[model samples]
Target chain A: MTELTRIIELFQLPFMQRALLGGILTGLMGGMLGSFTILRQLSFFSDALGHSALLGISIGLLIGINPSVVLLPFAVCFALGVTYLLERTRLWTDALLNIIYSSSLAIAVIVLSFVGQYKGGLNNLLFGDILAVRELDLVFSGLLLIACTVFIGLTLRTQMLLTLHEPLAIARGVSVSAQRTAFIVLLSLVVGISIKAIGVLLVSAFVVIPACAARLLSRTFTNYVVLSAGLGALSAVAGMLISAAFNLPSGPSIVATQLVIFLTTMALPQLRALGHG
Target chain B: MREIVLSVEQLTVYRETYAAVQDVSFSLESGIDTAIVGPNGAGKSTLVQAILGILPRQSGDVFILGQPLSCRGSLAPAIRQQIAYLPQNFLFDRRIPMTVEELVGLGWDKLGFQLPWKDHRKRRHAIREALVRVDAAHLMHKMISGLSGGETKRVLLAYCLVRPRRLLILDEAPAGLDVRGESEFYQLLYQLKREQGWAILQISHDLDMVRRHCDRVICLNRTLLCQGTPEVALSSDNLSAAYGSEFVRYRHRH
Candidate 1:
């Protein structure tokens, strides 16, 4: 079969429908929140949260509960814990984040080792299997996407002001700490939902790569946000199609697509200059 | 009687364990422009930040327009709406993609949960009016990251002027400007203060500008050393005391 034929045939299946819908929703959330993540210098935080979420999944599997449900609370705790430590103590921020990132990932590996019944499950968690996207996962991710959209839409102006300059935001009577906590919480939620389809290792690429591309191409803040979101969705869908065609892993495929888009954006301005020359 | 716009009593602000500002007491009345004149590391910026409730006070009370401001939490929205602040060389990411219009639009006093559809025209007009006053009308659509230092300062000044305010606080706001730019900025500030009847409190190192423009000056070096008319408070003894014994007043010859 041709690559396009394979992609179209795959989408005709129920599982592919679920995977595509989940990927698109996850992509939209990641893109929207990624703008704030990159601007606030929390790109690493998303990666850390992704790694930490593996512990929650391990715990969930051990306890015979849904990993997706457990990931919500687990991600929230990790995000809040980091926020609290950063605020209360004067530790170097990157050091603190790295400490948490390395330790949690190590602990998650140990915990996953304890789950001996599910052979070869580690590979699935490390590299996602979008074909395994369940109806429950879709529903959970859909609800999360809606919540994220409404929250971001309503608070975009206030969030933009705060993200631009926090002290100025504080002076303007924005509850900076409160807003920060809320933003990090929402970011964690997005990361948690995405981990199932994008996997722990590759999830943050969905958040950061699209935003990096959008930042290079966009002239205005609004344009940057919109473009980031659009690029994320585009990457997710196109990556899924490419994965179907080549029988490749979905997470890496999506990330590879995003990298191509980012490189294109980077070269566009230089290409334009060359054209003018 | 002129209303007291800002009142700070026994305000002590600590940076880590050491007090950056200790026992700073002051008040600003309507229509009076006050300058907080101090040398480097004199806690002048800390005093303003503490008063604005952006920093935690060690032990103190701040009252703005008779409303008590807590030292721990954020300022009340109502009180914040009545005041304009230009932070000291405000730190932020220079590569942000925000426009001057978006930055100034957020400065409107009535920004809350209200829909943007209502009073959209009014918000646009206010932003443009403030930008025009700052002589940055042409930069309304320009990216904030792309602006020069002087242009950024002007844009931020327009942010302060985007709404009606009874009190204005500036923290070394003209630090990066040239002499001509600084002079023009102070001229604009003077006109705005008079026309709006604003109670102004500014932290400045420019003794000449403070001496010429300020109605009162507060000399500070971690604490309030002296305060009075610039002629009295800026005396040789006060300057020596606040700025240390090595201080020498330089007078420029025209």
Candidate 2:
């Protein structure tokens, strides 16, 4: 068969289409939320939340439930708890993040060990099988993307700028607490949904590296969002194409493509200025 | 006489167990430009924070346009809309991707209101006008992270002026500016006061600037030392009390 015919046949299966749609939606949301994630210096928080998803996924597998549903509430609670503890306590935010990150990974590994008989299910989650995506996952991811897009677009001016310079925003009457809560919740939702496409291990990179690369290449804030989304979408599509062609894992390929983009952008003379290089 | 826009009676601000601002009482009349002058560590910032409801007031009554200040609820959106504040220091992540225009637009974003009006032309005009007023129109498209200290101050000043608030509170607004920039900034404030009748409360350490520009002066040294026109309130004794021995040296130099 010709290359075009092979690709067409690959997508003719319902699962491939679902995975592609889900990846695109997740990438778009990741790009948008990544802008604020970088702006607010909450990259560590994203990492912590991503790792915490494993615990939720483990529980889902143990109970024989839809992993996404279990993971969403778990991620939201983890995000909110981290935010509250950081704000209300005297402990340094970075230290708290490290604790959450390491502990969650340990718990997930221990729980997964107990359920060793479900190795196949755990492996599916770890290295997301995009070709195995269900229709429900596609619908949920699509709605999430739409909701997150509208929310981010509506509050784009206030939320992004406030995250950049909070005191200045506060002086101009932006409610810092309210805006922060909304942003963290939005991020958690994005992380929860994207876990299936990028897997919990690589999802935070999907949210961070693309935005960081976009920031280097773009001059303005709006451009950053658009460019980040474009880069993320490109990486997801390219990764899926390469993975299908080589019969390799899609999740790692997508993440690897993102890293390549990040490195390439970093090496460009004009973009290099963005990193203090 | 213009009405009192702000009244503080028996105001005291404590940082932990120590009293930072003690028994400070002052009233700012509308259309008047008042300067809060004191040495560093003399609680000028603490006093302003207390009035803005950012810092807790240990014991005091703060009335904004005849209404008691409330911190429990979000500052009344209307009141907040009508008030502008310029903080002393503003820092943002350098990697943050944003422009001066986007930052200034944040001034118009209030709670419970979806900004349905996306009139880019009108918003840009307003942003331009604010930038031009602060002599920062050229920097409107510049990345906030790339601007110099003085340029950043001017941009932030433009951000504050995007909306015409009844009262403008500037904490060290001219701290990092050059002599010409500082002069032009104060001149802009004076012109705004003349044309718009906006009340200005400047927290500054530049006594000379305060003498030249302020309609009234409030000297603080953990308490209200004096309040009135600069000539009457800035007497040598009051200055001495506020700055200890520095007043004598300042007088000699002047």
Candidate 3:
């Protein structure tokens, strides 16, 4: 098939449309929140949350509930627990996250061992099969994207301040701890929601790399977020197209595309310097 | 009317049963410059945090501008709005992505909502004026990441001055300063005290400087051993009480 014919064929499928929409929404939310994750050094927290999604789903399956339905609250409460531990204890953030990641992985493995019939569904969740995207998933992803944008708009500046100096933020009359908790909760929501599209194994790749790439390209914080979200959305949708044509896994395919974007962005600075010289 | 800008009764803090500060009580009158002088780990910073409602007080009551603090994590913004705090700049990560202008503006309680564009001239004038007073005007546009230890403190000092609060708390400020820098810092504080009539609370180890500049001295070590005029509070006997048996006997020239 020629390029035009292939493009026409790809857009004709309803599942393809849903998958592309879900991927785009997931990418946008992941990108925007990922900027904060990288800036505040919460990549480990996000990664831990991503991994814990499997445990949440597995537990849901064990209790005979739809995993997707239970994933949101489970992820949020888990993130809050992580946040509390990070605050109440003197343990380093990464170390705490590592403990959560490993224990969550173990729990997931243990739970999956007993889940006989729902194994295929769990596999689809563990490694996202975006080709099976439903209309409900598209709706949920769209709502999350809107929610994430509104949240970022409302709390972005204060969040930046809180991230910079918690003590100072407190002294400034900002509810430092509350804002911190709210931030981790938002990260949890993004991580939890994106798990269905990006998968447990590589969700953080979407949330972290895009922001880092944007950081190298951005001179201002505003530009950092804008570029991050834009790059993320672009990669997510484009990678879904590639996945469709080549029968690749949507999650890893999108992650690989972001890596390529980051590399290209990293090289742009050098290319510009060379041009100047 | 009560002139006390801040009052603390039996303020105590503990770290896993180790009392970092215990039964500390004092009150500050408006426009009085009080110095809290102690050795390292003497709970000076703890007391400052308690007053600011930053630390969880194990036991105590704190009143700021006649409003009692409930030790419920942190006080409301309206309460903190009446105060300007210059905490230990050494604790802040210099790499935080902020400019001096942005940081100094953050001192205002309402600046969080206002665009810097709308408040730029008024805020800039105030920030620059404060920066000019502290001799940090050249760093107005500089990223916080690039500042030296002394420069960061100066910038923080400007932040404290940007808004005219009724009370000012300086905790271990000017830590990386030389004697000359220390002299300049106190002089500026003294000037601000005279001009603004805001109660000034200084947490430091510079006894001589406090003696020369502050109206009162609080010699603290987990508890309030003594609080009075610098001449009396800095006395050897009171110094022994505050610093414990191993306290050094610095010769008082006066």
TM-score, one value per model: 0.95, 0.92, 0.89
- Interface RMSD, one decimal, each candidate: 2.0, 2.5, 3.3
Mind giving the per-residue lDDT tens digits that candidate 1 earns over A1-277?
5767777887999999998888888888899999889998999999988888888888888887878789889999989999999998888888888899888888877877777766537777887777789998888888988888777777777788888877777777778888899899999988988887878888899899999999988878878888898899999999988888888888789899999999999999899999999
Candidates 2 and 3 compared by TM-score, better number: 2
lDDT (10s digit) by residue, model 3, range B107-148: 643524433346557866887788887888888888777787
- Which regions of candidate 2 fall more than 4 Å away from where they truly are? A61-66, A267-277, B108-112, B246-254
Q: Each candidate: what lDDT?
A: 0.86, 0.80, 0.79
Can you give the lDDT of residue A12 in candidate 2?
A: 79
- In terms of DockQ, the best-performing candidate is 1
Go through the candidates in order and give each one's DockQ.
0.57, 0.54, 0.33
Among all candidates shown, the one with the greatest lDDT: 1
Clashing pairs in 1: none
Candidate 3 residue-wise lDDT, A1-277, digit = tens:
6866786697788987888888888888888988888878888788888888889998988999988888899889999888888888898889888998899989888998898767556567777777777898788778878777877776666766666677777766677777677778878887887787767888899899899888777645566788889889999977887776776777888999999999989899799999999
How well is each residue in B67-160 modelled by candidate 2, as lDDT tens digits?
7776532466677777778888676677676788877776655534365357777778888898888788888888888998778877776777
What TM-score does chain A reach in every model? 0.95, 0.91, 0.94
Please compute and give the TM-score of the first chain of candidate 3 against the native first chain: 0.94
Q: In model 2, state the lDDT of residue A80.
A: 91
Candidate 3 — what's its lDDT?
0.79
Q: Candidate 1: where is the Cα deviation over 4 Å?
A: A1-6, B109-111, B114-118, B249-254
DockQ-based ranking, best first?
Answer: 1, 2, 3
